[model samples]
Target chain A: MTTGTASARTRLDPARRRTQLLDLGVGLLATRTLDELTIDLLAERAGISRGLLYHYFGGKHAFHEAVVRRAVEDLVAQTAPPAGGEPLERLLASMTSYVDYVTANYEGYASIVRAAQGGHEALRRLHEQARNVLTDRIFTEDAQGAVIPDTPATRLAVRGWSAMTEELVLTWAADPGPVTRDQLLAAVTGSLPALVDLLR
Target chain B: MTTGTASARTRLDPARRRTQLLDLGVGLLATRTLDELTIDLLAERAGISRGLLYHYFGGKHAFHEAVVRRAVEDLVAQTAPPAGGEPLERLLASMTSYVDYVTANYEGYASIVRAAQGGHEALRRLHEQARNVLTDRIFTEDAQGAVIPDTPATRLAVRGWSAMTEELVLTWAADPGPVTRDQLLAAVTGSLPALVDLLR
Candidate 1:
């Protein structure tokens, strides 16, 4: 049985094994902060030796970077706007998706976002890249940027609004207070256009 | 000559020496990140041997906690709203002070906020306490909470506004682009009340 189990784990190629380990790590993030996800715990969860996990990730630091990058990629992909909709509808759809995404992945997402705030350079860069994709979606929604006006002040508003939206959503997801998801969504959805209107 | 130098270095009592070391660390934060403020570097700048510095601080981790605490206190003090003013004027005054404080202490301020996000527990608590103070000031500006009714929705908006303001100020301080400080201040100052108004 031991031989069979070892072979079952080793059946996958190196690339496949790395992917599997990362996926498990990401899954764990739903319940655990990265700091708390020690190598021993991960290895035990995966039913693999600690040495094997290290072999795949080299070390905790490298493993964490990989996990965060993967999480960011998932976040960016999930938050991507729809293929067809009016500007307002598209924006609402995007916002709703964001609220839902973070709602479902609050622990993982918050930790990643919060960690990026820390001095983690690699994570910060990854986070900034994800943020750019999110912010850039606003401009791309209207090719000429006419609706939003891609000037510095508008850009600043959008960036600021992004921060507001993220903060609100995270707070809402965590405790939600008296606010329902719909109410939360409406407020978040309304605020972006309201902020941009002020710039105009 | 050696004895004179040694005595001069030790001139301050231990408590005073500790404060001076912490103050020096905080000052360094204006230009360098806490991560970059190593004991070796601090000791060199303070003209104290690394051993003496270690004796005072115990370790780097404890030293960082003390520095972050002091920085947060300074930030809170600088951002306290005026004792008397119209709610709107007081809010604006507080916002402007916040912008100016961050402008002067951008590196230190950013690092601390960022580190708080990074899952540094003590730093995160300090950051949260600072955030609470900033948000709570919104309510205290009017004794009745008349201008800004302190509801869950309003509280959420205030918290969100704080995030937006922090992000905008930090970004503006780092790279104003075409946005002037006054313009940035106006946008930030205007946004908070506008956000609260929406909740109404």
Candidate 2:
């Protein structure tokens, strides 16, 4: 960063600086896994010091959580089903956005996955919260008032679908090999209805 | 206590002692997560000293890997598709065995999944090796020769299917909720052919 941005860090109000730090953290997640992101690195990247970084988020883990939460919120928004549409069309659209967003933010998405699978409590909650949002959209009916019954069994199937989508999207994004984007999306979205139908 | 099993730890040969240690580790996984199975706990359970534990496996990580490898090997064998049958029947049988094995070995299965997602290199490799063993079986032909052609696309689909199965099986096993065992099994097995059929 130029001296202009670096030295101007202290000029911002406390809340703005915190948000700035988190935004910088999210940006770093573009290239770094959550595990690799240390407070020292964030401090250096932001042209600030470690003590000041801790002053904002209190600790490294908390800072990681805040950045992860922001990224997941963006992802949840990106993949939300449209307000009005046929259910299947909305699902397909959502899946398309999901694949596009994850591919674009491959490293961040991967970091979130790793954090969730790790022993981190806050990240685990964020990961599940993000997932539940996406899974809820699969059954949420804007005008029709829920076409799928939203029972425990159906919920289980939907969670499975989410897992399937995550795995395929990440694996394909990393190395799509012979699998085209369209085919991948088709396989992911195509199997959901089939899976839910079995529950019914 | 009779003290027979506890004292015998010092009497066994090295190979037998290593196997005994590994087997004890596997048994502990029945009730505890891989994360929870500390070297201290294993040493205490085996009625042996931590120094001896390190002597056998060199360190805690290596010990965990060996124990996990043994557990995953058992899972791989348990879920192996039967040698001969109609494709769908063999698939169903495999799914049944898959669910049965995971439910029985729920803690170990969860640990393997968590370890695979975590940064642990060896466990991740073992997890993939076990998964590949299972996924490859989906295409392996015992007598009629390979049937699925095993393209990159199909392999991707199968991997996604495996992810789906893992999520569903783990979720369902934790709490079947209103879903019956048969329903869970069907939801998992029924979707595979549909997913594969989409490729054709």
Q: Cα deviation in Å at residue A24, candidate 2?
A: 2.9
Cα lDDT tens digits, model 2, A92-182, are: 7888999998888888788789768756778888898888877776666533534466777778878988898898899989897767788
Q: Give all candidates' CA lDDT scores.
A: 0.82, 0.81
Question: Each candidate's DockQ score against the native complex?
Answer: 0.52, 0.62
Could you tell me how far off, in angstroms, the CA of residue B1 lies in candidate 1 after the best superposition? 25
Clashing pairs in 1: A114-B117, A117-B114, A118-B114
Clash count (model 2, backbone only) = 0
Over A123-180, each residue of candidate 1 has an lDDT whose tens digit, in order, gives 8888888888889889877676646878778888888899998898998899987587
Give residue B166's lDDT in candidate 2 (0 to 100): 88
Lowest lDDT block of 10, candidate 1 chain B? B1-10
- Can you list the residue pairs that collide in candidate 2? none
